[model samples]
Target: MSTQVAPTSGSPSRMAQLRQVFFSSPIVAFASLMLLLIVLAAIFAPWVSPYDPTRLAPATRLKPPSELNWLGTDAFGRDLFSRVVYGARISLVVGVGAAVAAVLLGLAVGLIAGFFRALDAILMRVVDGLMAIPNILLAIAIVALSGASLWTVLIAITIPEVPRVVRLVRSVVLSAREEPYVEAAMAAGSSTWRILTRHLLPNTVAPLIVQGTYICASAILIEAILSFLGAGISPETPTWGNIMAEGRIYFQINPGIIFWPGLVLSVTILSINLVGDAVRDALDPRMAKRGIDR
Candidate 1:
């Protein structure tokens, strides 16, 4: 006679699993660290920056990197290091804010479209029309019409992002809505809202989270592009793109002006992209299991 052994639970807590996945790959760990440092620098810019980001010193114009000014001064004689530090705040705000707005709006549209056959055709046609337009072109048109400002730029960027998110969520919901549990919930006299929230919405979270990171990264890049093209926030605002735009004029004289901010922007985007990849892998059961088996 053989004695039966009870199966032990091996599943890890969410936080623990996330931590493990973050450190599983060295690139992911490094990216996360770099991203964290940039965020911290942005948050403490007012206190930690050596000089005022916007304050001009005509006497110090075009100065190179030195002990007095670590990253040197721009054409306006404002500290390059300080401007770059402060610029992080704008990038993060736009990226996060636009992504959140897009996701929430998309989620609502997607839920409605996926759940109801009548609305699906109408909503999908609208989504398709939006998708047909080039994202940057649409954003540029909106900004041009609305006049350039941070909020306008944010709205412009978000509008283009909504279609992609809506498509993703609608697909997920369409698939989930047909599942036995969801059908059972519907058949049991559950309200449409109740079935959506309880049965369909939860199924969309993982993919939405992954999609959100990509949206955030894309939003940051789009904001920078708009600013560079003079269609973003005010020129007076010391954003990364504005810094580069200002620096381009004096490119021959001092490349550091563009180099430093460009470097920061590139790294920040890369970090966000890397984190998104890690999150995708972590949230996917098949990917997680494959990683463990390997």
Candidate 2:
């Protein structure tokens, strides 16, 4: 007689499988929490900031941290704490916004290129040309011609980022296109767009998401470099990069000027990397063996 195996709690039902994957991994949970908190702070910065980041106090100039001014005052006596809080909004917005724009554009180009060999060859050649140039230099050149504004910085950083994403997506799509199910779908006369959208895109998420983190990190760094060299956002705005630029002069006198903002920026980037690493680990097929099997 044939015997049937019972479906235990660990059986691979989709929801149970997901719970096993996400919740069982403490690293993923912790990283997710950290990311959520940072995003929340960025979203609520305007409301949460105690004082106006720009409003100056000549009397309280360069004062150390106190109850009134938690991170103390800048050279212009603007509240450093408030500025840091508000700065999160700008940094996160520019970093993530530029990444999203780049990735979406890249995904479209990559999808077309991967599905059609002729398109792939043409687009990849353009991508290769872009890649041959140093990305920072390319961004600087773009910003120089475009003129510096928030949107200009966004576009400049985005240009180089798109090509990288395009290459990544194209490679993933090429591999996924050869899968058995995709072949079956093709043989069944599924439309090209339908096969790409339904089969290829979903499989591409893991690597795309991991790469996206690096893109955000690079975008933020580029913004900082651009602003430092006077090619990014307007100096009047209190971005971290501008703050660092201003702090350079006062480095000898107070040092705190650059200290806090730089620290915050470093921590934010590190946290993002940590979160990215955790996501990569969770998504790795090899790690699933040690993880709760559902």
Model 2 Cα shift for residue 162 (angstroms): 1.1
The clash tally of candidate 1 reads 0
Find the candidate with the highest TM-score and give its number.
1
Query: Which RMSD values do the candidates have, in order?
Result: 3.7, 4.0
Best by lDDT: 1
Local distance difference test, each candidate: 0.92, 0.82
Per-residue lDDT for 26-84 in model 1, tens only?
89999999999999999999987999888989999999999999999998799999999
Candidate 1 structure, TM-score to reference: 0.95
Locate the minimum summed-lDDT window of 10 residues in model 2.
10-19
- For 1-294, candidate 2 gives per-residue lDDT tens digits of 999987765534544435565577676666667667767877888887888889978899888888998888888989988887777777888889888898889889988888889888899999999889887898889988989888888988999899899998999889989999999999999998899889999977887887888888788888888888888888878888888888798787767778988887877787677666655655766654456442
TM-score of each: 0.95, 0.88
